[model samples]
Target: MTPLECVELQLAAYNERNLKLFLTAFAENVRCYRLPDMVLTIDGKAALGEFYAANRFVHEGLHAKLLNRMVVGNKVIDHELIHGLGPEPMETSVVFVIEDGLIAQVFFIPAKSPS
Candidate 1:
């Protein structure tokens, strides 16, 4: 699959809350970095499952809409707005590195817009 297709699949899995599909889109050893602190280096399917379970609560009913996407080779940067999880919607920028058709790493940075 093309890099763009891989990204699209990942987003679809996330939106549907299909954990198995979501995990399938990731590499065995995936590195996830949440800007400003959180970092998780997960290995194997079991570890990925654990990570998903731990974050499942935070993702309950959360929907993310991609505003823009820029792809350079295997790396994609997405700008999105997320809804349904908090008082005010949150905007975020995410960088995804796809390797061999699977997501190898992801970096998320939160943003605040002036009201």
Candidate 2:
């Protein structure tokens, strides 16, 4: 799938709380980072799957709306409005690195103070 297609599929999987589809969009040894710091948040597909199980679908209304998206070569940068993952909706940015049709790395930035 194209990078955009992969991101779209991942978004669907997140809203549906479908672990399998979520995993399919990523490479086996994917890495996730928190931006501004680039701190490692998740490493490996199995670990990421566990993370989704614990956090992705805590509420029935969990969903994301794409505010903006841009593709630069193999990277897909998405600015989104996220709901239900927390007490209030949040605006977050996600950068996806596509490698061989699967996401190999991700950088996540939350709209909160990084302290």
Candidate 3:
């Protein structure tokens, strides 16, 4: 799949809370970081699955609305409005780096602070 396709598929899987499907778009050694400070948040596919299963997928109301999307080289950048994690919606920008058609690294930038 293309980088944009991988990202879109994962976004769908995430909003549907489908842990297995969500993980397919990622590489085994995937790394996730919070932007600005580039703090490592999730490392590897196992940890990624665990983080979603334990912290995110459980929320029945969890959903993300894609506000905008841009593609450059092997990267897909998405601006999204997220819900179900808290009382108010959260706006964030996520940068996905694809390698060999799988997401290898991700950087998340929250509108307010680190997430």
**Highest TM-score scorer:** 3
TM-score ranking, high to low: 3, 2, 1
* Candidate 2, position 99, lDDT: 96
Best by lDDT: 3
> Which portions of model 2 miss their true places by more than 4 Å?
none
lDDT per residue, candidate 3, 3-111, as tens digits? 9899999999999999999999999999999988989999999999999999999999999999999999999999999999999999999999999999999999999
The worst-scoring run of ten residues by lDDT in candidate 2 lies at 52-61
Cα displacement (angstroms), candidate 1, residue 60, comes to 4.5
Model 1 stretches astray by more than 4 angstroms:
36-45, 57-60, 112-115
Tell me each candidate's TM-score.
0.81, 0.94, 0.97
Q: Check candidate 3 and list the clashing pairs.
A: none
lDDT by residue (tens digit), candidate 2, 1-115: 8999999899889878788888999999999999898799999999999888887766788889889999998899999999987798889999999999999999999888556
**Taking the tens digit of each residue's C-alpha lDDT, what string does model 1 give over 40-63?**
656565777786667643577777
Q: Pairing residues by index, what is the TM-score of model 3?
A: 0.97
How high is the CA lDDT of each candidate model?
0.80, 0.90, 0.96
